[model samples]
Target: MNIVKVDVFQARLPLIEPFIISYVRLDDMPTIFTRIELDNGIVGWGEAVPDQNVTGETWHSTYDVIVHELAPLLIGKSPFQIDAIHQQWDAQILGSPSAKAALDIALYDAMGKCANLPLYELLGGRAHDTLMVPRVISIKTPQEMAEDAKRYVAEGYKHIKIKVGTDAKADIARICQVRDAIGEDAYLRVDANQGWSRTEALQVIEATQHCAVEWYEQPVKAHDYRTMRHIRESVSSAIMIDEGVQSMHDLTEVIREEAADMLNIKLMKAGGIYRALGLASLAESANMPCQVGSMVESAIATMAGAHLSMSRTIIETNEMVGPLMFTQDVAGVPFDGEQLLLTKAPGLGIEVDETYVSSITVQRACIE
Candidate 1:
């Protein structure tokens, strides 16, 4: 059960289209994929989508931390001792959550494989066999956004998350246009990505009140809890904090201040499933709903997210559409339209194709 070898593969996958949030635009998704081989010959996989704007990490930094820092700490360690490993990581590593997340996922995957169980079962067992994931429409013109919405809806997606936080007036128009194109039955949500000022957030929310937005996410900056509370109180739509809630402590603070109505938990931000479970538990205790989300990642990370999403009934939405956004997947798993079917196979329940991975891999390393 002790980790004997670790392999890190860096790959760049071209997106089906350019994904634009308020802070950044990406035409290709750069991911750090880690494979940990244990003493008994069992292998586990993990993926990291490093975003400098969100996790304060890039591919190079993530790779360096995994190879030079985290790998030595992980080698010869039992995968079952996840809590101790996490504690050591928190003690030694300060802010490289994305880097730590890759290792965390790999360890969990190894544990699941060792026990011959799926990750969701290891987390807490499955609450649902399938998850209805929401497709995200990146920032674009009103017409283009509407078209994207329509296309996704036509493809059997029932939920769509629109990116906003640019011009208040244009943002309103974008929501309204997409709402019109998708009709009233499909659920519509908007993520501002902490792109707008409090005043602008309030103005846009008020203007788009008629568009029936299910929720408004991270309207202001991540640290401005006061303004987040103000905007939440000012609007009827539920307010979800994504960038704001990075840890259990952050979630506790947001709940204590009554800053947001919902929480968006991502493995990259929370570090891994270990911390993500804590955040979800804290949010549930506070009666705040949760949404499981991820960066633009391949199937490795997206499958990890799907395990977490299915493990808890408190997660009301799934935003693990990263695999769907790409033209190809580095791994293979069953996907029924927007819903990803959970596998009974061990670990994350997906198999990584090393051949395809190597084809797209830009960098690689092995630590033994």
Candidate 2:
């Protein structure tokens, strides 16, 4: 099938509430949603991580890159040759994984539609259709955090991931409050977002030993692999690396140095499904556990992650709750229940309602 045009929509959706963390806080999501329409009248959709602070991608930059840089590279290329397109695009952009990810996902969706197969099926099929995605409560006051955990449990979520990287004492108290509130039956995990000092991480992890944390992710900064290894050695709690293991280079270092017991894989950081799969393969070879994470995404990107998570062998946890957390989503099918489910339609197995889309789109570009 011949590729026709690439459409970039800059959209802003309100978060259910302002999501706070040590690094950044977001009340409104400013993102670029990409839709690739083929000449055969098939359309595939994807989302770019427009977190300017995290990836240096903003709505304007995403639109410019896709329309002026990426779209031209793929307009006439065979949609099924995913790798070839990536190789060409990689040569052009030195480090725009977030932008590249948007195009890559759209192209994959187009390929799946051309083949009349579900996206997961083309991605080596799926091992499990349903996965337990834990509910994440942003770090807050101990009392408020405990109430958040209780609310998640009341909503039927069996697991919770609390954001930390604030004061060690408050972080520990937050975890304790959550555990006590949710009771012993729910799984508990923490993401420090590389906000702690080595000493701080150590003290916090040691203090929370009573909380029975399933794992503590990126306790210290991303570059401090030495500290990561040290923390892994010093603590009884499992250590997972998030920002630390964003690329194959990072994955190599983490595995070679034995820096972590687990890793967090996010589509935005890993570039796309293919690169994500590569990271998973490396983790598999090293026998390391992985958790599929999100960078506040819509159902399109989250479902893309779910497809990858299912086909992989190492993912032990899931955090694809962006749709649930965001007040609005651009995707047609939002995640349902505690599991992130994909629709039965071909390709991404979802539809985009133009009405919802037009309501949220901050900008739009058409390449005719």
Candidate 1, residues 1-368: lDDT per residue as tens digits? 79999999888998999999999888888889999999999999998888888888988999998888887788899999889998888888887888888989999889899999999999889887568888899999999999999999999989999999888889989999999999999999999999999889989999888888999999999979999999888888899999988877788889989999999999999898889999999988999999888898788888888899989989878888888788888887578888788878999988888899899999899999
lDDT of each: 0.89, 0.82
TM-score of 1: 0.98
Residue 247 error, candidate 1, Å: 1.6
Q: Write the per-residue lDDT of candidate 2 for residues 63-149, one digit (tens) a residue.
A: 788878887887876778788888898888876777888877887888878888888788777767578888888878989999999
lDDT of 2: 0.82
**Index of the highest-lDDT prediction:** 1
TM-score of each: 0.98, 0.96
Per-candidate count of clashing residue pairs (backbone under 3 Å): 0, 0
